[model samples]
Target: MSTDTTTEPEDASLEDLLARVDDLETRLADLEATPDDSQKMVVVATKGTLDMAYPPLILASTAAAFGYDVTVFHTFWGLDILHEERSSALKLSSVGNPNVPVPNAIAALPGMDEVTTRLMRKRIAENDVATVEELVDLSIETGVDLQACQMTIDLLGYDEDDFFDGVTTGVGAASAFREMVEADVQLLV
Candidate 1:
């Protein structure tokens, strides 16, 4: 003869498990109803070049237009995009850019960057594409958060006044990281 020794959870333990599940479901419903339900995007801009500047700004503005909460964190050389004066005068470098038809030898020549920038500007105008300044303005008007890194600003000796009117200057990396952590989309440009 054989005896079965299987055991089941106590009735009290099963009741406790059901109660915990109920609490969890209630908390989840509350979270789903909160304002945090909106989609979020965080874009990290680390390059200052004119060509490099467009991607982040365009993405941020587009996301904002689509009703997503968007934040652009500009650090290192990327801070130039927020600089009121520098942004307007940004130039595209032909050197080391594979897209440019010019050979590296000729691209390395003096004034090539200026020529490339002029050509790019003409193309943008011909295509009726918005300039960097216009995109920045639109992003601001659409409520996209443009944050400039405090460390980069201090390192470059830039004052808050140097940035555009709506830009949030002197923001720390930690704050940007917090936003990134909560964002549904994170981009490093």
Candidate 2:
């Protein structure tokens, strides 16, 4: 059988539809050409536990790998994520973590935190996952900006020496807020 070849219907409706389609395509191209929100990402790290700390560091590093300008603002307990002494030793807090197999009462018992933390670290190592210290180094090497919360530092009586080398001068929440406002993507991890 021969293939059928037909020209346009030569009707106003079909012509109008084609013109609309062209307009839509042009607009779609314009939209695609515009800068993506992922161009910049700001992550707030506010937890110190092993389970809670990885997300911001991981996301910041991943964004940096994508050539995004990424900043991780460590506040409150999250300060441990960048602490030179504690970063590698950040413990899993099973007391309130629902994912842990232990009941809350058992988890809250003395010595349970140590057990849980060890188990978590063992699992992480077994899976060949990067440690917090490794992720911190990777993030710095990849140009991820890390900032410590000045207020928390003062409140916790922590000196600048407590943090790793890559952190910027401590920043208060206001500065972090300004960065967040300018960021195309923001996360509290």
- Best model number under lDDT: 1
Expressed as tens digits, the lDDT of each residue in 159-178 for candidate 1 is 88999999998689899999
Per-residue lDDT over 4-95 for candidate 2, one digit per residue giving the tens place of the 0 to 100 score: 33343446668999999999999999989995656789999999999888899889999998989998999889999999998888898888
Q: 98 in model 1: Cα distance from truth in Å?
A: 2.2
RMSD of each: 5.0, 9.0
Off by over 4 Å in 1: 1-35
lDDT of each: 0.92, 0.89
Candidate 2 regions exceeding 4 Å error are 1-38
Position 60, candidate 2: lDDT: 91
Output the number of the TM-score-best candidate. 1
Instruction: For residue 2, give model 1's deviation from the true position in Å.
Output: 37
